[model samples]
Target: MFYERFTFRLIFKLLFINALGWLLIYLILKTKLWFTIAGLSFILITSVYTLYSYINQIRSDIKRFILAIKTRDHTLNFKNKSTKGSFPDLYNSFDDIIKTHKDIQLEQDAMFQLIRTILQQVPVGVIVVKDVKDDAEQMEIAFFNEAAATLLNVPAYKYWHRLKQHLPVFTAEIAHIRKGGKRFLELKIQDKLIQLSTEVIPLNLYGADYTIISFQNIKDEIEQKEIEAWNRLIGVISHEILNSITPISSLSDTVNSMVANKEYLNKEDLEDLKPALQTIKRRSEGLLGFVKDYRLIAELPTPELEFHSIGGILQHIHVLMQPFAAAKNIRLQVGQTSSKITVNVDLKLVEQALINLVTNSIYSLEDTENPLIEIDYRLEQNKLFIDVADNGKGIEPEVLEKIFVPFFTTRKNGSGIGLTITRNIMKMHYGSLEVSSVPGEKTIFSLVFNYV
Candidate 1:
């Protein structure tokens, strides 16, 4: 509808040109005058050429627009764009396209810079490598952050081979692993021993494969962690030994004074020594028991692997601990699950671990008004979890942190290695023990195993 005026103008111009050409031809045929014919022929050729140029103007403009787009020349613009012409909508469409493209590019560049800045600021090293175009054997470094260069203690190289020459071990690790993995490696780079935590990730983008390698120097971190762990362990051992020995040492002095006070009197003085002597014996045995429990946790045997029925384990634990729950009037509920669900684990060790958890749960429920313990299994995200949850006096955050420390206990009579041994057993079975507590609400201990 908008081209109506354009079409009318085009038809009028065609008719005028046809009429002028016919008039020139008629004069040449009828008059037979030489000068007149020559003049008419010149005028006719000029009019035809002028008409061809008028039609060709739009095609030339279109060609220029396409060239500009191909060259990414956003500055090329139609100087006299009009709303009225042959298909007037075409006048500014090319300019609009260039503007849109420029906007998208600007946004993309801004986002890329933002991401680059973040990578540069982070302490962890990040490098992005991709296969060369049409060359699978060669790789190009698409991204290398400041942290990566600093961590490796080398210049940021753009090509993979150059970088590989400097860090052969790290490069080999990234090259060999196709899928993602995390590893802790001790590398000797530039005469310095550095421990690195490296993680590799593979991604497919725009039909091209890329490898993202992230690493961090963890030597200092590992040393710090070891120191902290040792402090906690030594602290626990010292507190337990002192708690036992302090009373024993004081009582020994009192017994010596009593013996000296009466060298003659027999039964009465001996009777007084009996309580002190018994007290020393009791504390000594308690300390010895603490040492034994610590040894049990420190020297756990590797689990002998076997596939055991999940339901069977739960059934056995429920039957064994039912009496303890009955004594406390705590309802121990075993969730119903398919007997078909089984796990690859050491039956004895796993059973012992569960028994320890359930026993702890039983104790935790001692003072609650309505006590309950529930044991259940869930298969989630390719992992098998056996959850032991209790409605009881839940563990406090501070106590929970130290519960797995050997001989660290809140209960007066607790040996405190129960959770430690349980956790060790799970580790031996290639599983993990995890606990979450909500002080007044509930506590859950999850035995996590990789589902096969």
Candidate 2:
């Protein structure tokens, strides 16, 4: 409809001009006057020029509108001055289209800003990667947040090829994640455990497919779960053993008292019964002590958190263990990396934990020549660590895994609860105990405190 309207108007203007030209020609021919011809010629030329200028003006307006749209200059407005013609409506249409496009562009920009803000604020590490189609070994890191760089220990704008050199474990894990159906994994980097979850979005965004990877630190969560399981098991075992042992202890005492009384048995009967009764009494008492240790494990008190000087704590431990160390001619020494270091912990519990580690070290050094037990405290990466190191016969690998289990002990007379209690104490303080040993060389037990 618009095309037809424009074409009809153009044809009418051409026909009117043609008629005017014919009139001018007839007047010139009939009058045989040069003045009349000149006047008509001027009028005809003026009319033709006016028509050309009007068409050129419309062409200029169209070119300006195209340029404004191409440049995204939505502020440009086309004014309709001629209210009597279709040019007015054409100008109005152009203005409306430009306004609509401006609104759409503003909305899109706002949406993009919102998305970027959300991605930046999220705690979990996120990285978006796009696989290259032709180059199998090349992958582009399209986006990565601050947490991603910190967690991977790599630059935020690194390609997969370079990232592999910095974090081979992470790159290898991510490669396996790209294979279908594996979305979660636990990776250890720089002695810190990280839990990773990946999602392959399979998005055809701007003609490419991309994958989004996410990472969470779940080490604390796993440790909490293990602690809960240990508590429950200890609770049940302690309850049952106490119930059985209490009655046996009482009965053994009663039987022994009766056996001691002459009226309770004859001489021969007394001789045979006394040893058996003594055995029963001894075993029941031992069982009672064992149950008590398990109960302690199950009912470990919550830490009374307070900040104490690391130097003071280590000095106390060294003094307390000196006599025992000297009895075996073993040298026990304590030192610190810094004199002003402090730790937040339960004083009694943390001391006990350290005592257990030091005692274990002392015991391990009994047979070695020039046996030494070195106790030292140091600050590393904002963490406080107390190490009990010994040049002793270190633990075997097979025994190391079960060392923390309750009632698992290598020493014949050990109650087997010392290390277990130490571990529990560390956990109560939101800390951890780590041990490293080399057979016939050295053993180091580190009590790591995360408190500032």
Q: What is the C-alpha RMSD of each candidate to the true structure, in Å?
A: 5.3, 18.6
What would the TM-score be for candidate 1 when compared with the true structure? 0.75
Q: After aligning candidate 2 to the native by TM-score, how far in Å is the CA of 134 from where it should be? A: 47
Model 2 lDDT tens row, 1-452:
44576778788878878987998879877877788778878878887887798788888888988998888899888764335455767887888888998998899999988987788788778888788878855888888887788777677865767777777777687776474323456777778777765444445688888877777666677789789868855765676577657766776776766667576577877777677677676767777787798798779888888888888898889878999999989999888634666788899998899889988888888779999999997778657788999999999999887788787778867878889899989978767899999989999999988743
Residue-pair clashes, model 2: 0
* Each prediction's whole-model lDDT (CA): 0.84, 0.79
Per-residue lDDT of candidate 1, residues 345-392 (tens digit): 888888889899999988888879889999999888768999999988
Tell me how far candidate 1 lies from the true structure as C-alpha RMSD in angstroms. 5.3
- Give the clashing pairs for model 2: none
RMSD of 2: 18.6
TM-score of each: 0.75, 0.48
